[model samples]
Target chain A: MTSRRAFLQRSGLIGLGFVAADALATSERLLAAVPGLDPGDPEVPNEEVARILKDLFGDRPIRKGHLTLDMPVVAEDGRIVPVIIESDLPMTPEHYVKAVHLIVDHNPDPHLAAYHLTPAIGSVAIQTRIKMKRTTWVRAIVDTSGGDVWAAYAHVNVSLNGCG
Target chain B: MAIGEARIRIPDRITRGDLITVNAIVMHPMDTGFFRTAEGKPIPAFFIRDVVVTYGGEQVARFEWTSGVSKDPVVSFTLKADKEAPLAITWTDTKGGVYRQTADIAFTAA
Candidate 1:
């Protein structure tokens, strides 16, 4: 364990130790509370999103607004589903987007990615392609530096599943 | 080291307060490390972890990503333009590879 910690430290990922430890603690606590939870699965269950939200924001409610998630109504390939997320929030120092998250409803791993942001980003828009396991709802959530959370969602119809 | 391509799109004639869309794609395998080669050896994971776009020496957008992104990653976003400027995009990969591309925008009287 010390060697692993040293390796991670040498890799310059020491700042991520808190997040890694939090995720591990959250998963362990969740497994103890939920029955039949698979330990091998890396994807956070859809039901666990609430727990994650609670963990991230204690008692702060997340509202569905202020974001536009552009996604294809029907995706020809599940391997590549293009998505664009734009936020209407101001990028001023007082109110800037801090982070964004991509979540899939039915994938083995629901939490696809998390993006940290800074005020240097003048616009709160992002575009990328994500792999979908099947036809499911995908969501984009944004957290602003001013302590506000906004989100939007879209449904993609996939012809075939792609994630393992 | 691999070569990456990027493109910036704006109206032929830029007027103040016009929204300009920029699209960029990088040539990368984006190996997820979940697949095995024919010899059954697992391929190491390497992908672009961060991409940043700058215009007029100011950052316009930035993206933080992971292996979940598709191969040959493409990103598009819009910026409200007030003046003509050169746009630059830089991508940093997980394997310590840095790629950059730039394009200039010409403003026409509107």
Candidate 2:
């Protein structure tokens, strides 16, 4: 019969193995979607952001107009920073916003979220809260069903680290 | 608040063709796994990864999120009052936890 201490040690090792495997799986999934993603590299956030944008928009030019990104100029608490995005662009059957991508330039994971929308949404107004690791630029990229992309960004000074 | 508990808010009065806003907040820790406890043990990452909004049996919006979302995440969006139907919001977490909330959009004659 196996000793109790030996069994506990073995189980702990197995648990650590599972945790490592789960982390690997997550990075693999992200790498598959964004080939340039290097989750471990500290200097890759900007590159990763650009790579993700390229992956989504290809060689299409991203216009700087039509999107309004609103967030606090200085976030006293980095853990919960409110963000609001509004666009004057029309939302009709023929012309509508297809997706809105949120990105934080310096976060460990720069790609915060991607919101896919339909014309039935009626407008391009969205509000959410995000965590910022440090002072960084928060970007809002809007893609229209017609293949055009508009981008805007807001600079936020974070007083505390939120990713811990 | 419980991990799966959610609160959704919508206008009580609605008219056909008028745009309405829906706001939802869910209780979640959104742990990023990068933090360590007092004993120096790493915290495991657990967060909601996907959220879907459907109206009248049709999908209107879908959100794919990472660990950067805040704890007790809140999301708001606008939708057209095209018909009187059930609006549903579904949240799916990384550990296979799925939480859902639905609210009926009853239209009042303009």
DockQ of predictions, in order shown: 0.29, 0.65
Best by TM-score: 2
Q: Where does the lowest 10-residue lDDT sum fall in candidate 2 chain A? A: A36-45
Q: What digit string (tens of lDDT, one per residue) describes model 1 on residues B34-104?
A: 66889999888887888887878887666777666788887766666665778788889987889888877
- Report, to 2 decimal places, the DockQ of model 2: 0.65
Q: Residue B15's C-alpha lDDT in candidate 2?
A: 91
TM-score of 1: 0.70
TM-score of model 2 vs. true structure: 0.83
Q: Per-residue lDDT of B23-75 in model 2, one digit per residue for the tens?
A: 99999999998998899999899999999999988999999999999999999
For model 2, residues A1-164, the per-residue Cα lDDT tens digits are 99999999999999999999977776565445444323432222344876777778777666677999999999999899999999989999999999999989889998899999999999999999999999887879898989988888788999999998
